[model samples]
Target: FLICLFGLLSHYSDISDMSVYYSISVFSILGMAIIIIYVCISISISIDERYPDEFMNQDQEMYFPIHITDD
Candidate 1:
């Protein structure tokens, strides 16, 4: 994230005005944040799908610890 910010800031410093540079930084940060959030959610969903039974067992254990001993 820092690398991207610094690279963009440096690249824009020579060609654009300060307002344009600042706006770019602001929009870039927001875009990066949104992309990061989307990636995280997608990864989590993939994990859930990949381990559906494991997650279901974990959830059941979390809510009903005593039920596990019946088996």
Candidate 2:
């Protein structure tokens, strides 16, 4: 709950340019907040968290992919 709220705040911080673009500390904290949100959600809601994202798993992989196919 708190983690999700922090993530939301940080997301807005970035969008509204509250965190200075030249600093790493603020961005790093926000980044961690976002990661914690995805990882710490209640297990009961995981059914919805991990599905229906079309081509991606929103909970696990938001940037990189772990496609398991013949490559």
Candidate 3:
């Protein structure tokens, strides 16, 4: 929906200032990145929950396959 709106506005309209469009694009990209990160974390957590650490060595903690954040 956002893509379609951006495309239509870019193609059909004569907007002098592109700042709004650029801002919208940046926001959309950020939104997508956040959503992807959330999905990845959620999937990893679900997998860990489904298959507990008992399968691995007792000395090790639960394995998180995807680490997106720096912390």
Candidate 4:
């Protein structure tokens, strides 16, 4: 939806010079909003995973698998 709106506005701007400036402003704002939202959501998820409850079963920690050779 955002991509389609952006493209429509871009085409509209090309035909109508008057709306070109405003279209650019709107486009930039939309782009920034999307980026801000993405960053916030990712950070929140990471924070949730990092701070776990003591009672909750935790995932096993990663360890290097040892290989043994029998002579």
Task: Tell me the tens digit of each residue's lDDT in model 3 across 1-71.
Answer: 78776666666546744765786788789989999999999988898897565457444444555334466
Report the C-alpha lDDT of model 2 over 1-71, residue by residue, as the tens digit. 44555566666543544443334456677878988887877553675566445334655555545645566
In candidate 4, stretches whose alpha carbon ends up further than 4 angstroms from where it belongs are 1-14, 54-71
TM-score of 1: 0.53
Residues 1-71, candidate 1: write the lDDT tens digits: 65675576667545667765676778878989999999999999998887656656887866776554455
Error of 1 at 46 (Å): 0.6
Which of 1 and 4 is the better model by TM-score?
1
Best by lDDT: 1
Candidates sorted by lDDT, descending order? 1, 3, 4, 2
- Tell me each candidate's TM-score: 0.53, 0.30, 0.53, 0.50
The Cα local distance difference test for each model comes to 0.74, 0.57, 0.71, 0.64
Clashing pairs in model 1? none
The residue pairs found clashing in candidate 3 are none
> How many Å off is the CA of 62 in candidate 4?
28
Show pairs that collide, candidate 2: none
What's model 4's lDDT at 58? Answer: 43
Better of 1 and 4 by lDDT: 1
Model 3, C-alpha of 47: deviation from truth (Å): 0.5
Off by over 4 Å in 2: 1-22, 42-44, 47-71
